[model samples]
Target: MRTLLLSLTLAGLLLSGCSPLPAPAVQPTQAQPAPPSPTQPPATPPQPTALAATPAAVPSPDEATPVAAPTSQGGSLPGGAIETLDPQAIIAATLRPDAPAWLIPADPELADMTRYRLDVTLAPDLSTLTGHEQIRYTNRETVALDVIYLHLFPNLWDGGLQTTDVRVNGQPITPTLPSGDDILGLPLAFPLPPGDSVELGLSFSIAIPAGEGVGNYGEFAYQEGVLALAHFYPTVAVYDAQGWRIETPSPQGDVIYADASLYEVTFTAPMNLTVVASGATLDHAAAGEGEAIWQLVGGPMRDFNIAASADYQKVSLQVGDVTVNHYYMTKDAAQGQAVLNWTIAALGLYQRDHGPYPYQELDVVETATSAGGIEYPGMVVVASWLYRDPNQRDFFQSATAHEVAHQWWYNVVGNDQLNAPWLDEALAQYSTYLYYLDAYGQTGGQGFLNAMDARWARVGHAAKPIGLPVGEYVNREYGAIVYGRGPLFLVALREQIGADKMTEFLRQYYHDDAWGIATPAEFQTLAEAVSGQDLDALFQEWVYP
Candidate 1:
């Protein structure tokens, strides 16, 4: 969740001075999402310490067992030709019938652990949002659940969020706020047993903050005619091996840890504003004289984000069956196209190397935020400033590629971002290396590594252990270790075990943990399983060191 802030150094790049114009409200249309690109076996498997001419060969559909392999005319191709594709279609094409085996599990016992139906109305001035959420949750844990916690992430900002009333299973309940934090807890009137479900109706409001961020920590910002609403909802906290994860937002890095669940959102806003959110758009219609309602469905994803602006424009391209969209303002027309190309290329490269992207669409929207790029499921908010300087084009590309990589590392494969930031962040940074390798080959890939090494040295090369919580390091040290040194660990592993085995290890890891949170220990176990050698010494030097 690194926020790459690009200052508006280039003049006349944003149309912030221009008067806002009304945008026409149109019904949302469905598009076909892409399928996995076909893979061919390697001509000769490279020996240890050798990089393969092509990327390491991934498991073909036939060898992965019981799971139905993609068929030329059935799984990949659909309805005689390219027909309609939605989240369900994307899942059917990309996921195995027994997807729960490796990906996010949806057993009857745990399918509805948390389900949210949020109905929201945006103010005409684009400064606030009023909403009520209908949340249906089940006590899926083995023990009797006594309390439920909801995280109000936006509350961390000044004039941020307020919860009005809450009811559990239709009975009004007083919510208790945690001390010096943004968490609200509701003690269950009666202990909720496993397999039992309850409904919570909550009312809340959020006021979008106005101003530039201090660093890479802007959330409720309204600037340049764009409104970025990230982590704005009162989300249910995750209960895992350590119980409820009720931690508050931290300044150093991402503080969210959640289980993938379903969401159906209804957003009502001024007719002129366009809504871009996680998942797929199910419906859109006129709400009233000057308002419209958009129905969106997403998940089982860890989080959902919605961004809107009156001045936003979009350019889209079809890759295989999937549609990749780049949203930008009038000033970023040229940069918008560039982002779209890089997104499409990155998606293809990751799909070929890791696995199929199990979503119908991916959006890269330009926004003003603290981060250079912030990732959400099937969507990301990219810094508009990245487009201002022509000389820093590579920086823009690397940032965009890194965020897109999170679709697999952070989105599909869930993680405890608060406890083990390296699990996803390090892998995402390494993914940029992979993208460079796939796009520009060995020479360019090594160049990216050399740049990373130089940056690490400039940061004084502290040699801190990469496997640590977000709070352990300062912001700069966090970036230096996780984004810079963390990737080098993978490079060293590649050198030790060969590129083919390293890629195979990653493929296995992705396949096994596609739908669940994984820790460094789990990764090490998988690494040893695939490489047939102990990596304790290696991990000690770079990761645990």
Candidate 2:
């Protein structure tokens, strides 16, 4: 969730944005919706300190609104960047993403999860639209899969009854839930034959009012030309080696993933806008005059995302096989090389410390929406506030680092963020601290971590942990715990297990749960089992104690 806002805000113009640890994740109780570059710095052996000046972030434009296009500006890539191409295929090959290849690695069904490649075309009025999804399945269990279920989260966006037309392998069908597990309740549903695989294709219509989703617009926000979509479709909840861990989205919340998959997205918009999405661009084909199709190919990922705009300043950074891209608003703080340079250093440092980045290229798009940050698989959207003034550059850097780390935590590890929001987001938060430590140092890192802690104290203490259920927590408190307290929990856990053991524990945890969604209980079992010690109390403190 920490990375989500960045994934949203950057490409927005105060026009579209994702919420950050809001007061309550009270969604409509129905389905819900929600919404980086590296630059090179001097080889100064980046310090693991605050990304910038030493004050807690003041909810300025950069913090609240989404990213937007630059205003009449010309900013070049920083010192060590190559901004010429999208580099989508290069990375796809490296990730070797293959969905529906049941016998392959990105096995969604096996994990009780599946993903679809989507193509959408929206009318200018925002009230009418079209979408297509490519679905794949991989069975995680031995059950003979008689059907395939899909999610149409957008159904929740409107009135939960948008007319949709689906085609599985080119054959038209309607997979909406019927009977007990009503497809209408899910927004989408479908089935496939047992132990076999086939393509699930869909073409549907959707819409939104002009300037909708501007601010706190119910469970989700929607506006023509600007969209923040989540839970817009229906999907089968995940049930794996663990259990039925189906999570739902609520007000200002996010869900969890167990298995990461590949995403290939193609979107068409009025010719004047720019498109930013998950994965690399496979094709930028010309449609009729005044129109174009942006083909995005992303794989070895759990999910995919795409956003479009007419105004944006494109930027890219490449540091030893790792390349990242960022979009700045014409109305941002600083433009050009300044942004690029900082990002390059951030990306390189991240690559060296954690693990080889899984994706080939990173895309950061600015939005007019609000919120500090949000993360998708390979793409992210950030607010323009970080670029609103030169005084705020460092926060921009910190925000960038935080979102990039999500590719590892929430996306790759695939944990149940609802039950243990701390599992996914907290890990990402710690990852941010790691970035600061690498870029700044102990003093700087601690300071930044403390600031986040302070924010949590203000919020978490005021509300109760979201207790409705693990699924309900997606729109609940683990953010405060996982992101805010989760790191502190790690800090303490490190003390208990010894730093060396912490490393060994993570190595084993990753090895066991690689590309699979993990539950809090599963993680706890792993931790205790690895340390040869009991940690019920430790987890209790971090969560409820």
Candidate 3:
């Protein structure tokens, strides 16, 4: 969700101007009107176990044996090829058998990427979850590492997370929560050298919080039968030049800052519920009585998220090889259909303007969230309330486009959203403008731009720098500056350069930094390079000033 209050302001601003273009009267080429199989009888839940009982000595690239190519189901290759010392089995288990070929990175530069295998079960009441996770963490920094930190996001909410059976390299170890309950620090028995990988395992149970009044747009909560699970697991903290990024998240911005990693998850849930998650589902099978297990795999993704509900109805369309699913309640069928159409339009526009979306699937789900929309890896969550309000349709459409834009800005090419919220949020907002321009022409585009100007007007159009940390802004200032003034800066840059150069810059930035972390400095440097002009003055006036 961007800012609910700003969304209201934007709705009025757009309604006062030219109305948005009518949605294209196109129907899905294929639709799934029925839900999945009914709930089965309950059975015994699976227990957590280490992916590999004993750690094996990983071979160097030269000494590694060449494995067979990935099969139809996404297969894993030796991590040695990518520069990590993780065993081949660990890598194999992390990728989905049905993962699209493009989702796997062939680049040698991404060798130190993390890999995770998770086996979790959701309770029948949607009130809690129990799981075990195995992580392959590589020390990508130049220096050796003594301790690793994991962010326990649920600890900050109403209900909490309890972790047990912590182990490192098959050996039991005790973990400490040094920086509050949220940050779990594991002291390695031996310092992990640079380029080396360590296997960590743990079992956890989370008491899912209720959505109302919860923080971060209530992304990690259960509300009205919908479960929005974002950052519900133990996520490794990012270690960069600033050392560990474990700072307490401000109430105004996104919380998770992570590296692109591979994930293989087996989630068991009540059969009556429909689960829409990041990546492609390789298999859906009955686990026991009224439960089913979904086998999913995604790679080179910043984070993983899942939205499950017993009441969800789905509509699907195939855009090329990508399967787009829109999940919503029956009462919101019209809005859900509109969201699906807009999502398809935005996906096509972004693919043409920025770069190809590598994933094989994309999901836009109507969730019980406070924010307008929240973007995940291959999925985005649209707030359900937006569907019930006829006057808020404009904001709803724009928010949908904005979240889809995050596929490129946040998921494919990530940044430190805590410190540089504008890196993705601003770009996403600008991309929403482009979407309107492409889909609805100048009249539609101008109306949306007018809404942005209105948002900036909330702060009296201050000349504040768009490059401030989330904590630096208070109240509505975070939305006013970052979401409002920041995108305007991008429009200004487009004017300073040329429309053609601006387009080139976006494509190059996305392609070059795909599945990698980007910084403001790198963004400016790329702009200068692509435009063949120094961008110091422009960046200074808008970003640094």
Question: Number of the top candidate by lDDT?
Answer: 3
Q: What CA RMSD would candidate 3 show?
A: 11.8
Poorest stretch of ten by lDDT in candidate 3: 54-63
TM-score of each: 0.81, 0.72, 0.83
**lDDT value, candidate 1, whole model:** 0.67
Sequence-dependent TM-score of model 2: 0.72
- Report how far residue 74 has shifted in candidate 3, in Å: 20
RMSD per candidate (Å) reads 13.0, 12.0, 11.8
User: In candidate 2, which residue ranges exceed 4 Å CA deviation?
Assistant: 1-19, 22-117, 124-127, 158-163, 167-174, 177-194, 212-237, 241-247, 256-258, 333-342, 389-395, 459-479, 529-532
Runs in model 3 with CA error above 4 Å?
1-104, 107-111
Score each candidate by Cα lDDT: 0.67, 0.51, 0.73
For model 1, give the 10-residue run with minimal summed lDDT: 15-24
Give a tens-digit lDDT track for model 3, residues 395-481: 677888899999989888999988988999899999998986775556556656777887788889988899999889876677878
Name the lDDT of candidate 3. Answer: 0.73
TM-score of candidate 3 relative to the true fold:
0.83
Better of 1 and 3 by TM-score: 3
lDDT of 2 by residue, 1-545 (tens): 32333323222211111225321223123321232222334235333322321121110011111112212122121111111112233233335232123213532333333444556775654445566555555555665544554444554444332534554444555555543231332221344334555455555565543363433342234442344543343444565655444334554545534356555455676666566666666556668767777655555566666655454556554544445666655454255455555456656665555445565567676654445567777766665544563333445565666776676667767765545556656666666666656655555566566656654564555334322233444332444444555666777787899877776776566556657767777878988988999998877755563
Best by TM-score: 3
